[model samples]
Target chain A: MIKKSLGIALFTACFLFALCVGPALSADSVKIGILGPFSGSLAFNASEMKKGMLLALEEVNDAGGLFGRQVELVYGDTECKPDKGVGAVKKLLTRDEVLVVGGGYCSSVNIAASQIADMEKCPVVVAIAISPTITNRGLEYVFRTSPNSPMFLNGINQWLEKVKQAKTVAFFMENSDYGRDGEKIWSELSKKIKAKELAHLYFEIGDTDFTTQISKLKNLNPDVTFNIASTTEAALIQKQAKELNFVTQWIGVGGQFTEAYFKMTGPISQYAMGSSLEPTLNMKSPETAAFVEAYRTAYPDSRPGIFSSQGYDNLKVILDAVQRAGEPTGDLQQDREKIKDALEKTDMKLTQGRITFEDDGQVHSVVPSVVQVQLENCEPELRIIYPEDRATADYQAPQPWRERECQ
Target chain B: MDSLFLQQVVNGLIIGSVYSLIAIGLTMIFGVMRISNFAHGDYAMVGAYVAVFVMMWLPGPLGWVNALLAAAVIVAVAGVVSELLIFRPLLDRRTDIDMIMVSIGLFILLENLAQFFFEARPRMLADPFGGNTVDLGLVSTSQLRLFCLAFSCVAIAGLQVFLNRSKTGIAIRATSQNSRAARLMGIDINRIYTLTFGLGSAMAGIGGVLYGTLFAVYPTMGAIPTLKAFVVTILGGMGNIRGAIFGGFILGVAETLGGSYLAMEYKNAIGFVIIILVLLIRPQGLFGQREGV
Candidate 1:
């Protein structure tokens, strides 16, 4: 009689274990975690990205969903800080138990989030952070849908040589990881392009003034001033640069291609070419066209920019991987493994360009470009001027502030 | 001197004037009331946004005049409301920290409220002085900076004249000296408190309008100035009006030169380092003395 009771208890224990683990592995709703600075200083980019990602997500869910399960977006607000990002990602993985994660507008925040997601073995599809080292770390579970930071250097330097004839290059950078990366690349490549580089200028994030930096730059008088600052700082520098008359050919690097720069600087923003991961407004991918149209229709009060395109494409990459992984078979570990394997082999055409990954998980299909906002008939028109094939307008030789028509 | 050095000095003075305007208001408030009013910065931020909106609505050149006038009056009224509703009720607090905590709460409340209404994105007030510069022989300065300097000088002079010569000003100073004694001498301490707070807030409002005109106006615009005001107050001797003005110029010049010669990243450190050095020499600050002084 004692033996019979023991056998019955063991059987119940096995049943309870299965009951506990089953739903976690296979649920009717596929939980995908999205994170970024949804509030705070980066909110402008975050809002644009959220809108873009949501648009893609709705379309994906509407089209029979991923793996025949409904897609649900669970969000984590990182506030664009590294430590905050780690905490947010932890909750998303441990509490929400998200099967997939998508987001990253700041490089520092993304690097931190990816580390946490890596430990949990959760696949994170990166949207917009541009640090090259993020992919070079050899994390199998991490994939990026945006161009890396250094990718802009060669293109920018090439354009500088071919068009501008800038002999000396000056760098005004933010004192952060992405900005450091920019400084490193520009300094390294400037020698290759036979251009002399001046001492690197730096500013902390959120500083309103740049008079000192402007004074120094004007004194040194480099031919091309490469400003690797955030969107707000870029606006501040350009606005002050015009006032100070220090307008060497300004080549704005990452995170500066937002609408705010043009909106705030107005005519002063003219003739400044910026490196961007998003395809120009006239890029003819049917998916890009549809995304832009839908974004406009949905957010009439807002104008979508680079983050919007990156967010949409990042979602597409993640959803495609999930679709390949198929329905959860009540084994989360097994399904996660399948999703990782499927993400490795992901190859498709999406917004911006064709979407595919290299061995290091950097998206090889996304082509970065340089775009200029010109006044055509007294209205701002964005034009792509790089790589020639995608050229909507010929690259104009950059001139000093004294020569520009805007002055 | 080279143009760069000359340019930096001019830049320093321009920034100095704005700092002086903001710090004077903060020092005045702290002088009369023991409350730190940490939300002083947010008050400036609110004023800046109000100024921006006024400019947007008024159209063309009058927007500048209207923004400044409206911001000063509106923010002054808000200060009266803030004191009556917030500080007046908290007068019987258990400790000064409670009032500080309240001010901090006000800081967060005002910042978030501005964000909620204005959105987190920065709003730029169309500057009547943007893209224009004045030739000062050795170097040129932006018209915006010149305008800011000119406005601050007028405002500071006006405030000084009022404080020195007017009946209300004397009553305010008496309350600052001894609220209990002033109350016994037939001065309405609460009325003095209300007037002082309003005047201080009006100063912040003008500072805000000028700040918004020069730099971008956003919810967090006042944070740095507010912090710098603390430094300026401590450097000038807390609650000493003249010292705040002196500290503002000193801090601004030190920051600009330090940023130029030392490093831009450590620009903020320059002011603090000076503060540390100053405290070591004069515990009372450059102008600080006894409570009455």
Candidate 2:
């Protein structure tokens, strides 16, 4: 009876081992790491990012993957936290032993994770973290395909210079790396334009109440408010500002150029303009049109936004580099170095813009546009309103909240 | 500047009332059961999601009433089930720390479950009162906020009456005061516990719906309110209903006013600062009676 039981246990153990480990061992794929806030406050962004990444990976595999090996993705959930991001990058670089890592959503998380990649000597192609310090720090392995904070305001600067020229400006910023960098750059822009800098108010990242800050801003009552926040906080700020009947030409970073922002705020979102690297609705190039069509086919119910394009570009850049790097020489470090070298010399036209890295590892070819949320056929749609070539609609100077025609 | 100060005050009071509503629910659960239910805020998260689901079936202004009602009912039932499945089993064999740990585990589980079922995308509850503002002489506020304030007041007053005047309320108070004595007096301790949890959870649900209306709702939306609720409960004296109400208003006003006058970044820290001062000055809380008394 004991021998029979032992034999049964041995068979079950073998079955479990094969079930868990056999596939991993048998799969001859080049492992690449992708990091994002997979399961936290910013989990929605991660899902959108993943869809874009999967689309890219799918296309690559269909076209016969790099060096005849299928590309496998190892996802590390940063949860939008810096420490968590570092841990994820560490695990991806050390344990997963991925050839290269890509995709970072939060600037703070990306900044921390990039250091870990640099230390590990693995190339990390950042998809969408905009803090200038990310590339400005001069990290060799850290490369950002997305425009940095300094470049983000280029289109907005044009808008502010010509139309909707405001004399006074105030900042409603979150107290994070992203917010600080935005404040620094926009504050400089405000000074450059000879616009008087009014009260600059800051709030914590996850704070639900902005009434106090709004009240402070209302007292100063600047002509324009440069607000820096992610989707949730950004929506709340707008809603609260409207509740207080405080009206201003609210300009946001690329964070507001998402479908979720429009859906969350509804009609109140109308007239809010944001500077975006990729205006999803206003497809400027054939490359962008193709990518958007592919995205729509994959995600039938959803529209691809800024992060989606960034996610696609992140993977595509890595794949391009890998293709140039030639066959993996079996040494992990050597293969990683080869990819890093190729990544430095990358210059390709992507959906967002032409991707070309400067000496600082920052993308130099991104063309930004300012898009406004307008109610088109009773649906909130983002229409490009700046950089005249891409302007789908003229910039409409908004009426006060109480005066606006909203159903 | 004067109008701004008044606006800040009005905003504080309105927001404070919400704090009171959520804190009262948390205090009730603690008072009767001696369980520091860390999962209390997640009930509000559930309530918010429930309101979202119900609003889909019933849209428009009047639909908000139905949505709020649906949230309260569903979340109350969730509270009861949680009590039976988790707390009731641990009631006899566990320490306070164990109960707290379990509640925290339950909190994380509920949050993740919500995330799994409803993606982490922030959802808005349709405005019950179409975006309209009621103009006060000194300051103007939204009709929705005023409605939230009124609702919070009415709900709190009703709870006060239920506790002071109703038969079940008396039994609940008795159980809270001394569960063993109440049991000896032929009170069903188990029933009172279930009722308290349900009542507290219902208040949390209502608070959630109102809060969701004010701010967007998502999976982790409950964390801030839960932390604030804890601060209010502590400030009001844990398990003290009247104290929770007053504490909520004080904390709310204090935070807003402080945020206005002081640095905005330290606004949330105001709650913790109040906690420290309260702990140092009056450990029993503002209205908490002595242990033996």
Candidate 3:
């Protein structure tokens, strides 16, 4: 009886959800699905991504919407799960009947949603997720505005080669697809540089205690440690490493540079090198300055992360395609095809840099900068120290940490 | 290698002590009420938030002490509220499963509520303890971790004393053993349940504050600890406090040693594996008194 009741309750909840979010077809508006996580651990970044997309929507409408019709954004919250993302994409494609889609925050979620979009022939503009495999999936509808791991790997290798000091190395890989790619790249690169790969360690995404891992690492005593964890995990690991007096020349492929990393680790995060998409200190392009200013003006209380910037750029790319598509003609199928065709030939300059994608809808060789966590003007910031033209600061190796004073 | 071994051991012990507090509370609730109290971790989360406020409002040398007390008291109050509002209503149904279901519901509700209020971003307390280390021969132990270990031991010992000596604690124990007999002896079972819940929640509260100081305070921060607590409970038996402590340490040491010896990827998974081995060897738990069998 309890099982029966539970089934009934679940059915009712689903029915209610469908009723509440009933597909409203607007004949005078062009509908585009915006996919992102609205809940879960990643919900915070997803919300930021949403804010960026919302800003883009208003901007597009302000300067006259696509095909002389107001663009209506249909948001699909995937909650950062692969299965849930596919479900969101299904709802967007079939129920909402969206002509085009924008936004894919988490790499795993984005890849799942984009895979579905490919099957449905709906164009998807990828924002934040930077796993190279997502593009390598051979999906025609999926196009990433952000740089991938292979691109960041080049920057990382370049920086490491320039230093020429790291002969023995260790890697702390998160047991996820993103980390798997990093492990592959870093492991292969170790052979090229003839560095001793002491240990290729792994940890769960949300594991708080890194003491045990660091204890094992301390014993191995590698000269350099390559970290491939998320922003929080990276910060926590670094903080614990400092506490344990297990200091090394820290290196990260991507996903470590953040305001939270500095705030959480404080001065201890100093001199750690990592690859980043965000131009933390020096804005090479005028557009980056304007984007930052506009973001700050819009969200006074909060600071936008790299994900938010990616969201904004992705939307702009999608809008560029919509304008290039020229006319909607009130037919959803034809309008979608037109957007897809236009997106294929998308060549434009944006805040990050000149944005373009190959036939596989992936941006390769975007030239990410090797940045060091450094103190500038009494604030901790990522100072780009590689790619000489983009370098705002010089590279600094991890300094021997001072003994922590008692309270 | 010797230095690393000692460091890992110290790390395991420090982290294990915190796990013991959380597990003891969970075990106490299950022992008396037979309710799993899956939302116990969220209770810890609530306490951590309370600590954050307390620290901010009252800043000085004894600020952290006051923050800890405030966290425990506030979380204890929250615990009583959960009992009065949810558990008390479901007691008439005569089903332990109903109470467990309510706990799961409470967990989801509390997590979402915390997420709504706190957001998903992690918040950290200003380091009152700072990042100071006290070298113990071969291994350097952080002052903050030492504080967490010492506080957890004191709290657990105090709870043990309360159970052995206090009249109310005896009544609670009686209720756990024979509810009908306790009821006939004029001891209110409902009151006992409420006290047990509040006490258990307060223990979790202490764990939460320490967690916030050492690691971070976030909405979903309680998740992994809760899973580990469950594993500890299994090793210590369902509702035994002494067993919870032993089990927590055992699991912690096992995880640390396993991670070091085998693979770091198996760090979290190793504890569960140990629990499985223990279950296969002796089902009554290491400290569990064989009741019927």
Candidate 4:
């Protein structure tokens, strides 16, 4: 009886192992790794990033192939958590044997994953995570295609200093590296506008309630509330703020400009301004317009937003670097080094803007846009409100809940 | 400052009522089934999804009422099905670890399924109240929130009456006290257990609709609420109905007040700390009885 049971256990163990380690990946394809929260709360954004990368990939493969070998992607779902980010990166580097990695969506996830990629000598071209610490560590392999935290709010800063001129500010930041970095940068920028800091509150990533913090803000009633949250959290915070009768001009720094935000909040999102790497409605360049057209054609149900643009640019930059670096030598270390060197020397005009990384791996040439949700033909629309040259609409002052005509 | 204090108190009680509603469901499941159902919170997620689905067909004030009823009934049916298909087989098993592992597996499965069907995007129920606020001097809140609080109170009261006055409620109570003795005494314990599971899930579903009304609903919305429910269950004493209610309210008020007066960062931590102190000081829980006494 004991021997039979032991034999059954051994069979079950072998079956499980076979299930886990599926068919081996062919060695012919050039593998690139992608890290994002593909399954958790941020899955929609991650899917957008993935779609962008896939669009870029489709263009290259359609033209023929990259260096006579088809480029394939290996995805690592970080679920926007730091510990999972570490594990996913380790798996991609060691198990998948990817040449280069791209598409780090969340700042905290990117920060954790970048460390492992650097340690493993794999080049990571970050797509959207804006925390400066990812590149400030001076890691040899870490590079950012998107602007850092300070550079991300250029348009917003210009608007605050020139147009709005707010005096008092409050902060509702998510409790993470992203939020902490946002608080630091915004606090410093607040000094330029001479806005007194009224309150700074932190909420966790998955938090759905904000009444406790919003009530406190109601008492203080700052001129503007600078919020640092993803798409969903931003919607909830603004809705709850409205619900509690705490009205203010809400400024979302670098995260809340999305299709989901508009859908979730509707008219409650009116007058709420946010900073975006690329304007959602207005296409900056012919290249951007073409990319957007191609994206809409590919994904019929969904529209490409800032995240898709980031993903598309990141992949394009990587593929461009790979082309410049010539054919792979089959030597992983030497090829990775070649890609890193080629990336450092990159100077190209893509959809968003010119992609050029400084010594710190931060993009210097790209200028972000400030956008506000406004009433256009009885519907709330995101309009470019800053950088007078690119202004689609003038910046509107804060409107009280009852005074609003749009809803 | 006085108004702020009053505002915080009102917020705490309002949110506390939600905690009580969810914890009652958790306590009922534990009290009768003796299963540590980690997926109890997913019932709320399911409820929210159902309500959102119903509201699409039925819009306006009448739509919300229909949405709440549909969510409760649909989630209750789902609970019965889950108990029959999943938990019923495990009922004969002796080890406690299997039930825990299975419940956790259920939690992951349900979350993934919701994500697959509904997508991970956060959605809001169309507020029929149209952003109307109820102002009383300095304290103000949305009319929708007040409605949710009132609904929660009514539901809890109704459950209390059913458990005390109804025939099936007596059988459930009997089974909870001594399952083997109740079974010997001609009570169909399996049917009673299934009914109890359905009732508990219905309560969680109602909480879900109210919660989804106040906040955004998505695939993983139930995760935090479930964690809070567990904390409330332990604080009120495991398997104690009255204890869960008081425990939920205390936790909600303490967390809100602590977040307001102290640091917002420690809002969740305060509940855990209180639970720790409770464990060390009173292992049987604040309102729970010593076993076999």
Candidate 5:
């Protein structure tokens, strides 16, 4: 009886081992690393990015597994710190042995991680970090799928000239890489457009008070106040601006004026304008609509933002590159180079728009959309107002403050 | 230079008032219980959330007042519960380190629970004064900030009165001075502990409400202020109320001046540096009594 029990235990142990290690050890498998701020101030955004990437992976796997090889993703949590980001990239490259690394919601963290990828000769596909310095560093291995600050700033400038016809502008930028880069881009474009810089107010990340900054802006009194900050900071600034009776036009960038922003700031978000690389409202394309529906079905609780969609597109680009590179024959370095070359050479249409990379690894073509905040039944809705060819709603600029004329 | 200096000083005072409000509870708790509650910040966070919820339900002028009251009551209840469930049981063990660890655990638990409920969104509580600025000719200040300063002064005076006159407050002070002797003299140590915890949490709640009004409310919003409060409490000498008030104002001034002159990013670092300097100069703190005194 003892001998029979021992044999049975050994058989069970062997079965469990195989069950756990079978897929990981399979020869026809491609592994990619996803690193981001999973447990810090930016965890919510990171979670959204992860969910979107996972959904894209699921779709790719369902459609025959990336050229007959199953794609695998390994996640690294950077906690939004530069040192942690560097450590995460090392772990992904050395421990997980992933060919292509993706993820990073913060610009500083992304820059740190990208440095490691460059040193290790691994391709890093960034999803939504908009610091222009990330691409400006000229790292051949680093490629960002999201539009940089220059693209968004240029788009906003064109819209202001053609659509809004605004003359002067006020700048309220956060003191971070994303905000500073955005301000620099805006400064260059404002010079070209001959827009006056009325007030240039700056605040640190995690700063709660904005009375001083708002007061300065109110005194300077420009045509519009451009809030180039995170969603939370922008919400606070906007609310303060309204309370101070500084009823200037408010324009934001990079999906800052969304449902969450409006909810946080309450009625202050009304009439705010935001520019997004991803379509905000009236997604008319059947393919885009289908993707959105699938995403909604998968994550019923969380809504997909522009960054989430960009994350999904980044994953698709990497997976497509791996599939085109064909199966690897135990040579990871060669496979990585081939995949990088394929990523640079390919042209694919994602849920957002056409995906083609420039020589510097930035998205070549993107559809920029402008959205206006409108109150519907006491709830804020981002009504698309630009690109009349694709607009589903008419633009109604908030009546100028002069016309309202408070007693 | 004069305009910048005056502005910095005003900024310091406004920010100092906030620090004093946050550190008052820490001072009270340390004075009475001799236990450093690491979860004080989490209580502040809970108060901020409660204020937000109340503000959403009640609109206009009454909203701000109700939010403050609601936060105080909710945080007081939470403090009582924590005392009954965690502190009372740990008292018999005489394990101060274990209690500190438990407080840390509570801090993390409360922060995570807040994240779970709030989903990491930073919310702006409506400024009741409508961003009205009061220009004193020399410097300008916001109505909300002036209100905070006035509230802090009132709160400090009220606390002084309570500590001096109230029977429960006397028992708390007696327990802090000599716990074993107080217990021998027929004082209910448990009740005093509970009262101290409640009082401390109430102070934190008030701080939270004011903070939410002045700034934005987020799950991790209490962390930086809490750290600053710790520095203030330490510099003030643990258990010294007046010292805490002085330390808070001093640290605030130092931070503001540092930010204005040196670098804004290093504002938080100034508090730590002051704490280190105090530790090196006077190990017992600026206002602390000598050991065995």
Candidate 6:
């Protein structure tokens, strides 16, 4: 009877081990969380980010997945709200239990989500949030895949000095965190460039009319106008400026140089210049060409915009991190650390260019391209005219005022 | 400073004209119904969208005109439908606050619906006048600005004539003064309320079209103008028509001039301060009548 009882106990123990270790010993699955504003005012940009991410995921999966395990994406829609973003991060971490999280479009949303990541010790890869405060907070776990505001503003300043030859400047900005931060940077840079700020107009988020502001601009007659607003506001301001016949040189930040702006303002967009991290259709790079072809094939309805390219690049960075980390073990903490370490040491050549992260987890190598609107045969075109080596189109300098030329 | 001051004033006037049209509609609705239509701004947004669609379909001369007509018709129909479905039912229950709340709900609903359809991108309504600058020697002006000012004046005159000569207009005025008395005198209270709302919405729609032509149209385009309209209506006496026009111009000019001379960033704050001062000084408006009839 003792022998029989001992044999039964051994069988029971073996049965339990098989039940626990069966799935673990099989192929592993790596889950990555994507968070962004998918159902709010910035939904279009978010949607672009999603498209880019999905395309990269498809490419990665086709190439035998990340570290020979299936890479899965879990999406959380923050709707461009801070509270919603915080909630989304919590859900992705606790419920989804994703190893790596990515995608934040707005600066405020990124800040809130980054705080959550810091607390949970989960590494977050920001796709396109450019607020300087994101990095200034000194969060260890937060890594931005896109360039921060300072780098972008510094590029703008350099372009203004070397290309536009701008001296007197006026600033028009929206009164939000994004706008205020950008305004501060631009203001400081303006002084550095020896440009006098004639007027700095701050508008609310939903303001439609700018006649008053434009008229004030006309009166000041600044040599150049810096529109530090979103693409929508920039379009409206440009249209109104055209109406007032205020023919001054115009420059805008990242959000301002897009197909939507060109379509809205048309010919009036001429002589307007802006900077972007991604290349447009005019770049004609082999990597960009391949992306455009794949994007067109995948998303027939949507045009491959600059933001989409940035989003796709972000996904590639994440996949590279996962592969470099080696095969995912069932252990969550161990896998997360490996991925984070891999990201910190990323020096991969990507479609955008060679991407490497600094000590603060910010992308070190970023090429900010300056583009200007030109009237090519009565049609407005966005021509990359700065950084002559990378430019695909010719530069047309702004026609100087009669007095300035005479002087 | 002189040239800058002059330029700012000119800018203010152009902006002021737009405020006048929006404020007039809000003032009319409040004066007649004694209910603040919070959804009035959404009506403006709808108008802008309608105008944009029209311009896209019919691009050329008279595009602006077609857009104006389309905005008026669409907003009028929407106003009538709201009265029939939402406002009239609430009125029967004697729930004024509920109606106000309903208007707010409608505002959010319409804005979201607009997002679903328009996709948050700002669309430009073709400007017939284009961007021709009329150099007025000292202060420059756009032909579009001149057109906007002229349009506002004509609209005000036409509305005045309709209120004075038209039979339905007199009934609306009578209803605003005394709803029960008008009911007793055989005036259909429901009809008057519907007509007032429809007219007010039509005015708001026209304002949206004009504003879109001058600026650009987006889902949240109506919010700032809507808030300004509320301030203008309250400052001009809740139900005063002429007072709304005057208040709109005053607020617009003040904001423009303040931004130019004082601080460009504080332009909105300047308008808010004016409202507070007016409320403190004369509880009524600059042109508001005393409550005693």
Choose the strongest candidate by DockQ: 4
Q: Which tens-of-lDDT digit does each residue in A250-362 have in candidate 1?
A: 77774677776667777777777777665346447787777778888988877778788888888888888988888877576677788888888988887768888888989
lDDT of 3 by residue, A1-407 (tens): 56446546754774685476545667678788888877665666677777777778888898788767788888888776789999999998988888788888667777678888888888888877778878888887788888888887788787677765588999887787777888888888888889999998899767889998887888888988988876678888877887787778888865666556666777777777888777335365787777777888988876666766778888889888988888777677787889998998888776667788898897653567788878765466777888888788887655555642211
**Per-residue CA lDDT of candidate 3, range B189-231, in tens?**
8889999999999999989988888888878888877888888
Model 2 C-alpha lDDT per residue in residues A212-259, reported as the tens digit of each score: 999889889899999999888888888888888788888988775676
* lDDT, model 5, position A364: 57
DockQ of every predicted complex: 0.27, 0.44, 0.44, 0.54, 0.20, 0.23
- Candidate with the larger DockQ of 2 and 4: 4
Lowest lDDT 10-residue stretch of candidate 2 chain B: B129-138
TM-scores for chain A over all candidates: 0.88, 0.91, 0.88, 0.92, 0.85, 0.84
- TM-score of chain B for predicted candidate 4: 0.97
Q: Is candidate 1 or candidate 6 better by lDDT?
A: 1
Q: Which stretch of 10 consecutive residues in model 3 chain A shows the poorest summed lDDT?
A: A398-407
The alpha-carbon deviation from the true structure for residue A181 of candidate 5, after best TM-score superposition, in angstroms, is: 1.4
Clash totals for all models, in order?
Answer: 0, 0, 0, 0, 0, 0
| Candidate 1, chain A: TM-score against the reference | 0.88
Per-residue lDDT of A43 in model 1:
76
User: Can you write out model 6's per-residue Cα lDDT over B1-293, one digit (the tens) per residue?
Assistant: 57657766777777777888988888887887777888888888899999888888888658888889999989988888876665665665656788788788777777777876788766777778756667766676678788888898899889988888899888988988888999999999888888888888899999988887777777777777789898888778889998888888888878877776688777788878888888899878888877886
Cα deviation at A209, candidate 5, in Å, is: 2.0
Q: Across residues B199-262, which tens digit of lDDT does each residue of candidate 1 receive?
A: 9998998888888778888777878878888888889987888999988888888888899988
Candidate 2 docking band: acceptable
Between prediction 4 and prediction 6, the one with superior TM-score is 4
Predict model 6's lDDT versus the native: 0.78
Candidate 5 residue A21 C-alpha distance from true site, Å:
21
Looking at model 5, give its docking quality level.
incorrect
Q: Which scores greater on DockQ, model 3 or model 6?
A: 3
Tell how far residue A158 is off in model 4, in angstroms: 3.1
lDDT of 4 at A267: 83
For residues A82-142, write the lDDT of model 5, one tens digit per residue: 8898898998898778888987778888888898898888889998888887877888888
Pairs clashing in candidate 5? none
Quantify all predictions' global Cα lDDT against the true fold: 0.81, 0.87, 0.80, 0.86, 0.77, 0.78
